[model samples]
Target: MQKLIRRREANPGVDWAEGGLHPLLARVYTGRGVAAPDELELGLGHLVLPDKLLHADRAAILLADALAADKHILIVGDYDADGATSTALAVSVLRDFGCRHVSYLVPNRFEYGYGLTPEIVELAITNGSPDIIVTVDNGISSIEGVAAARDAGIRTLITDHHLAGTTLPDAEVIVNPNQPGCEFPSKNLAGVGVIFYIMLALRAELRRRDWFAGRKEPNLSQYADLVALGTVADVVPLDRNNRILVAAGLQRIRKSQARPGIMALLEVASRSPHNVVASDLGFAVGPRINAAGRLDDISVGIECLLQHDHAAARALAAELHQKNQDRRLIEADMQQQALQLLDQITVETESAPVAMTLYQPDWHQGVIGILASRIKDRLHRPTIAFADGDAGEIKGSARSIPGIHIRDILDAVATRHPGMILKFGGHAMAAGLSIPRDAYAAFHDAFVAEVELHAEEVMLQAVIESDGELAPDDFNLELASALRFAGPWGQHFPEPVFDGVFDIINQRLVGEKHLKLVLSHPDSAQLLDVIAFNIDPQEWPNQTLSRVHLAYRLDVNEFRGRRSVQLVAEHLSAAE
Candidate 1:
């Protein structure tokens, strides 16, 4: 069972209220570390300066010089949504800047894996012997690839956001916000955001040279939509700086001034661009673009975003939509199989480990990350799911609870047992590694031991933090709508979820594992609509209980031209 802990909601927001923030918004903002009302003003003017990033200005000078010399710039991108959008943004923006020699190549994940690998560099060379290589969203950890590029007489500029390794790449210029000496306050920039900053710096460099003297200077804000899409899709924390970037992009999408590819994606997802929100990017748009990379080539997604023709964009978006559906079906089957495997292991012991690991040779390598995430959520433990990799190695994707630093655990395991982990890279909560097939047992033991060394009792249990029950006055369509569209919420800046006790007036199973119910306040006669998805049927069978406590978010459900406030119950517990 999950534990629900009420957040200590603060009401001492006099300064915030004086700054013209709504009273409710003030408390909500303060609860989430927002001290002043001005902090919530996510305008383009609020963005952090690009020069603050270490070496960013230098990187900009290098790129500007390359462009001035009319050097062939081949973009090397990772095969993911962030990489795809970053690649598209680079290609589109460079072309808009009147550079005809700009192009991109996203490595086939199955063949080349991630980053600008030596093989990928050769493939890039085979495709075209570009004079310069501009890596978007990758290449920070590519020690060999950078060397290979240099040997081939190609200059390199890497604009990545992933954490840098102990040793940096030998590139012409590196513009990662998370690099060792970077004092960039907002280090959580997505790859797209990093490139966007580089673009900003490049524009300043060009302006210094009077490059726009005879040409129309491209307003880079036009690419903000791509930045927003990639930022949200990558699930990066929406700091004040990231929020400004995302909000600017969201404004463009709402105004129907989004790129043709984004419009096409919205169309396929059945979302109106006029009403698109940040959540739509994560749940709807990101998945479709990711499907191409997971199931096929990421080039499809990049090409879809690059197309200026509305019809062509729509057609590619439709194909991408179908691929997403196929991905979902495959993911469902894999999840079920994973659960079965877990059952077999825990069935005998009747208990699960603090660190769980599973391997399936037939699993699709591209989908293992999502699979690991799902299983981690289910078990409420650090989990790793493995798939077959090239050679005799098995690639593993890992996901962890907030308390467990998965990448650290991998490093520890590798240190404790040498020649075990061939290679690994990732952030705090998610990571990827490869191990020899014959050493799976040793690797699993080392990994689990490291997790046990780090797992605390509090970390092992799942705790759902919630804002205490909303008053009847707070439960209205206005508040719901305001909360939904007031600003871009993601990662650290979460949408509000309130907890309360309600009388179960009526309940019925709608779709598989979903419950539709009519809920009523215990002391009020007013009725409310509630939809609980993926709820275990055994937990709310026939709704025999008269009342129950629920942790839910206020959602605005719209149909046709009508809209209503609905409660989306995320968690439930017995009433006190």
Candidate 2:
């Protein structure tokens, strides 16, 4: 059973309802730590300055010197959407700033693995023979890769956002908000955001040097859309600083001021840039870009983002769309098989699960992370899913509930059982690990014990938090549209969900899986349309239903140029 609780509210020092905020949304923002009306200001001017990030100015100087000296610059990027966007942003901004010879390389997850491996360095040497190498979204733990680059006489600068390990890399300069001693207010910048800041500082440095004496400095604000895409796709917390970046970026996308590549991606997904939301970035475009890196090289994704021609970008976007479809098919099959495995485990245990570690030799490594996340959501427990790695080893991806710090759990398990875990690193919610295939038993036991030790029994139980029932005044389209544009919601700052009893007027299935219903409001004569995607037939009957409390968010669904308010139902239970 799932428990529902209303979030606690805080005073934001104003009459929010009277200050142009919908009453429903005022409480929602207040619950999320907003203290005043100005906190919701998402204008670009409200963004935290780049200089607050440590080493940002130094990184700028390094890049400016390279451009002035006509040195070849190579960007080493990880194979993910954040890395793809970072590389694309760097390449685009550098070229625009008169850096004539600049290129990028992303390690193939299958061959070179992640980060700047020695093998990747060798490949980079053979391909570009760069004078300086810039690492984007990776290289925080790449001790050997930096060494290899140094040995090959290449200067290296590291710009990343991941938490650092015990020892830092020996790069010439490092700029990570999470790095030790950095007082950047927002440590939540995605890899792409970090690189974009560096670009901003680099532009300032160039201006200070009078490098643009005769030529105009390209406006770097044009790249904020890509920054927003990567920030949302990377799933970093939407702190106020990050919200500013995303809000500014969304404004550009909505204004059709986004780049050709971003525009093409929106086209392929059948999304209007004018109406694009943060969810669209994370769910639609992110997956398509990530699909290329997961199943193939990320060059295709980077090329798509870097392409200036609309037609060429569309061609690449189409290719990415096909890859995303293929990825979803693989993910669905794996999920089904995993559920079957879970059934066997449940049968053996006959008790509620606290945690789970599942492995299938044939499972795709690229997809295991997504699978782990799914299992964690369903079971409401810390979950680790392993895909076959090198011979005698497995690559495990983990996801955790709110109360459990997954990375700490892994560290403790590894500490207790040395060599049981070969290698691991990640943040609080997610992490990656490697272990011998034969060590699955020990790994599973250790993980379960650690999860139980760290999390309370109540946390293990499935619980859903609601923003409470909506008032009669909240049922209008004006309120729905206002709520939608309240702010760019993500991660820590969640979209609002409210519960209310509704009488089902008409119900039908759409696309063979979705439950589409017309609901009547409890306190009014208004009829609301709702769609619950991928709901089980058993959970929702074909017969018309009445008096069910629905936890849903307000949505605006458009069809054939006609726009109407729609309720996107998340959970439904019999009204008490």
Local distance difference test, candidate 2: 0.88
TM-scores for every predicted model: 0.98, 0.96
Candidate 1 lDDT tens digits, 286-398:
99999999999999999999998999999999999999999998899899899899877763222568888888899988899899998888778888999999999999999
Give one digit per residue, the lDDT tens place, for model 2 in 106-130: 9988776888878988999999699
Candidate 1: where are CA atoms >4 Å away?
11-14, 347-351
Model 2 earns a TM-score of 0.96
